[model samples]
Target: MTDPLVLGPLLRHVGETTASVWVQTGGTATVTVRSGERSWSARTFVVEGFHFALVLVDGLTAGESYEYIVEIDGAQVWPPAECEYPAPRITTLVKDRPTRLAFGSCRTSVPHDAEHHGSHGVDALRTYAMALADGEVEWPDAIAFLGDQVYADETSEEMREFIGTRRSLDEPPGEELKDFTEYAHLYALAWSEPANRWLLSTLPSSMIFDDHDIRDDWNTSWTWHEEINETQWWHERLVGGLTAYWVYQHIGNLDHDALAADEIWSLLAAGAGDSEVDLTAPLRDLVERNDRHPEVYRWSYTLELGDCRLVVLDSRAARVLEPEARHMLDPAELEWLAEQLTGDVDHLFVGTSLPFLLPPGLHDLEAINEVLAAGRFGGLPAKGAERVRQIIDLEHWAAFQSGFQEVFELVMEVARGTKGDPPATVTFLSGDVHNSYVAEVIDAEQHGAGSRIVQAVCSPIRNPMPKGLRVAMSGFSRSLVRPMRWVASRSRRIPDPAYPWRVTHGPWFDNNLAVVEVRGDGLHLSWYAGEVVDDDHDHPRLREVSTVDV
Candidate 1:
């Protein structure tokens, strides 16, 4: 029999009474999810010639573990007989249980062997998987992949070889993904690694896409969008990227209620119990419309676990690119965000792929650069500044003054107990800077509310920034704050940040994954990097880089 499951049995949206298991099959097959005496089943639906299913297993008891098996066409296909790891299980959330999450981003699909190790380092996720399999570490409630789950624009050597065998690399966009088939292949390469695949099967996961998931610096500006749109292959690239994202990443993120409300799912559900439905055209049209009018659909979501709430923002797709009124989140998204920012929980976590808070020095520089790029100096100087902004990746929260202030104020309000009973901590969890760090917002009044604001960043589950560039970044981060603030003072266009902050923990450049555990009113964060202690690539170890408590 053909291997029906290709990409997942990826456990997602696990709750007190329900669990969602996402899987891709080789053909139209009946997929069943068995947990103890209960079972949930669904038939795979076709999308661009691929069969996929999200089986929602209900009637699960809260705070209970249920070992599950995937059966395609009434034949068991998952948890292979030769598997060495523990049986894949789904644990529903308990009301009194503490919130624990593992988060990291910017993982590239490449071989885990030694030759690739020099460039990509050991895969931190894989190492973490080993730890989980060995029962060396507690399984987090969920793993939040902040961004860049797949590098659509940056192909690995293996991926390039596959692409070359199927299509000409000399075509426009060359090595980058051109269509849905390539993206599907890219995801297979990314998640098919044995250790990571096992981890994904058992652990609940949430994900959002970064620029590299589509192309580098995606939606950075109107000019960038216009230039790319004019390219011959960009239309297909956008449609495929977003469509695959919806099928693979976004679908599993939603709860049963939200999934039921989704129009795309409704369209697919309509074709169920019949011949395989080819949703390529409708899916492409949905993506195209969402691209042009981002406010038409929302990607941001929030999940409440115990006493805490995790708000995952769509930083990339929800951007407003008007030069004069640039904002990271469009008005509708910002309004939605405001609704999510309220505090009734013991802890509040905001997850953004790009950090809401940068190192103080870098923050000031980007804030100033934003004004310069907006033509505050006018003519060629502004043009040059815009180029610099794009080149150095200065576009972030600080670069959009309105967005920065709006979010800052909202966070401040939540912290101050204006929205509800204040959370013990308001933490922003992020990745994408290719480093790990923790920063705390300083409260001038030494107020209890002010003490709760913090930022935790973990990045590059495999990719590492070059040592030379790391050194340069460190020096620049240290030296730029004062001068950039001084420059901002002289420009009417730039405004000073309301709350001061400092990097309290790190700027570590190791390829790492981070975990945050929230207990009652306390928070603990730890960063782990994969290390090949000996020459054993198959059994790389997870070494703790640092841990901090807030």
Candidate 2:
């Protein structure tokens, strides 16, 4: 390959008249994106020997479709001569149109073969891409990948092969990512799949990281943090993970104004308009500062899609883990969330990596576990509780009762019309739970809010739960109903939820992706999966698994 373009021409933020394109290149070169006679160009920025650019395409007609091509140093690099699909199109959002949002999480990178399919199953996202490319389904306004886009702790055979070349196979951390270079390779492997790559190039997508993006149970608690901080490889891993995430995922999340306001963007674009900017040193400082003080930079982002307002929160990196003051979000982050929870929009969607409303019994169990881990029962029991917390992944909104309650209070305020006119529906879109389910705040303290507060969680776009866990989760969803109320009521440390909820639609265990369409009456939600018919792995068919109207 003589092209400098390495990874992406990913369509990031797109508005009525503006769009941003992100690309990773193999060398220092000017990246240009052209639509018809109009072209936009940006010089490459270097981060640890890696070159990238985010070029903004503007002044386009609203609600119009424009086929775009990528050029490196004025030579077309995208839509390679051998490409089978059409040239990627930048379709800007149409004002007043109902928004179609697709979301999922927890996908693993692996070769698509019979052996891997026996475990991981078909990639629903890729199948969706194929369908979209073939005009079988309507295009979504955007897709928000909740988390685990790449697993840092769980390496694939390809990742392990790369890791083996870099470090000793028998060493500590082993196949797990060690630094920025490894993390870079991991992202490349994750997004390089052909159908998925073409889908991403054309679809405006936003993302947030969950624990597996760095490591499982990342920032789960203060004790967990203290232990990881003591490790030799962790510091580099932390910095590298954040650095790669910023370069790969975070920058594309912001629009024109938000990108201009970003500190890192400002530094890279400071005085060098046309010259190449090397941000390796600044990136290291950024990751170090952000890890030491989580509030230094905000990973959370907000976007507007027609009548919908989407606020994607950063539930993993920015957290208060200390037992005395544990929260899913820190003080500043909580305040920001409160502000963003305002109404005035027809639909408000909060995208969290972890589900805000889990199964009632499991939620109460987590609530009690948080207290027990903090030495509520005894010192010895606290140790046991801490170990159990990590074992079953007991960290979620319920695990941090204070943050959970406070955020709910803010949500209630918006629902009650305090912040602004209450939205028709307040939906929390999430992944990372490995299963798909829908829950609704029902028959509790409404406090004058007529809005439908719901939680729609879909996950593991490629990975599937074992039959054993599927059975356990199915029974867990139904059986936890009545007793969990009593279980939660008994704990004085755990106050009753401001709004009681129940699982309304499903606890479906499938390798699936879900979509939410903002309609006139209410919201329509559906989950779909890729079914390999007749054992045809190369041409999986997209099938709808379930549908629910909110």
Candidate 3:
């Protein structure tokens, strides 16, 4: 066996009574995983040039921590001699508990220093998260990675150098990840750190892909697709992007129930499935079709963790982009989401890559951009609108007005108790915009229980907004957006008790990590960001930016 590329060793709830441990490694080796005296072993095989395995040990209780090890290739490969690349031992998931969840997304793997990190600002968020995972602090039950788990479009200088080292950057698609091998290596680089990899193995993670995971403005519009197809390398680019995405990210996010119920899964179960499920060919076809017809096979899934129900929606890929009746969630997906939102759970957490709610001014800006694309404001040439969309990432929820409206209505209905008693809270967790903030829809007339609704926006676990753009976003939200919002509210309001005014819980402009804890009835949320104290890189301190009890 060659050097093992171990992944996960995660604990996930299989049923109300059973739990499973998931792992993916590099070579064919006997992997012995132990929770105490009892142990289970599985033989991991390298298929499609990637090592993978799943071991299910039943009869484990929820909310209990179990310590385990991985022995591969006749050696204890976990808990490495040096805490460097390729992570250490695995731990059990935070099974079945009303617990704390740490979630934020849009991380780029730049260095931690300010000037040395190649223009992406200091990776304070990564450093802080790594510190917490390395036992500098307590670990959260689960970490929800909202989106941009990787940026396929924007490659840092270090990444370019690494890719250029092995692969020819002068090829068809250049350094922007033209194939699956590049994507695999990118994931390795992203998760190779001992602390971060161990953190993922221990904490149960749920994720959804965003535009950057594929390419910038992946599905901004049909016109964008047409223009991309016009490029010589786009065929390979799309195939590689979607194929690697399915293998590296999407496959793990599914539960047994979801997998069994999926069309592709059913085919695999029948043994009539085209290539083996783990191989590259099947993934290539499904992902290719997914990119070609974004709405054909839905990538969305739901998780019922005790009393908490997490509905992670696929805002991208499955978009219904017809102008007459558009939506982010197609009718079928909307129905499925509405069914899940019966609010039988204590807290309803909706995870999507893009926030359903954006700053009203930004929302208006999107509408204007759309209108301009239709040639109202002398839009770009024929493919001008598509080009502009790619430049500014115009494929957000704001762009898909109908789908955004549907999800918003669904959330509002759930919050208002359409099925059972209203949930203690209905929180939308999102990360896409490089900045993070908590915005609450409030009834200005009264505060407290009569509040409209709460939406928490956390983003860029590592990436920080550019300085000038951050300043502009702040200025627009404060100066221009505030007054214009008031005037617009006179005509366009979200009905009585649903006053659309937004009160930000905190300020922005910091690379940060956020945690949300549900204790008793109220939900306590806190934001933490790292502050550099010295050039020696030892005195990094994590200070609380803001706290709110909603």
- Residue 15's lDDT within candidate 1 is 83
lDDT of 1 at 150: 96
Best by lDDT: 2
Query: Would you give me the overall lDDT of model 2?
Result: 0.89
lDDT of 2 at 33: 93
Candidate 1, residues 1-550, lDDT tens digits: the string is 6688877889999888888999999998889998767789987887888889999888888999999999988888898879988999999998788899999999998998899998889999999999989988888999999999999988999899889988899998899999899999999999999999999999999999999999988988776788888999999999999999998999899899889898888876777675666777888888988999999888889887766899999999999998977999988999999999998888999999999989887887888877777777777877787788888888878888889989988998888888998888889999988988898887633554632899999988988987877875575456666776787778776777778787887789888999999866789999998899779988999899999998
All models, RMSD in angstroms: 1.4, 1.2, 4.1
Over all chains combined, what TM-score does candidate 1 have? 0.98
How displaced is residue 315 in candidate 3, in Å? 1.0
Encode model 2's per-residue lDDT on 302-400: one tens digit a residue: 999988899999999889987898988888998888878999999999999999999777788888889889998799999999999999899999999
TM-score of each: 0.98, 0.98, 0.87
Q: Give the CA lDDT, 0 to 100, for residue 317 in model 3.
A: 78
Q: Is candidate 2 or candidate 3 better by TM-score?
A: 2
Output the TM-score of candidate 3: 0.87
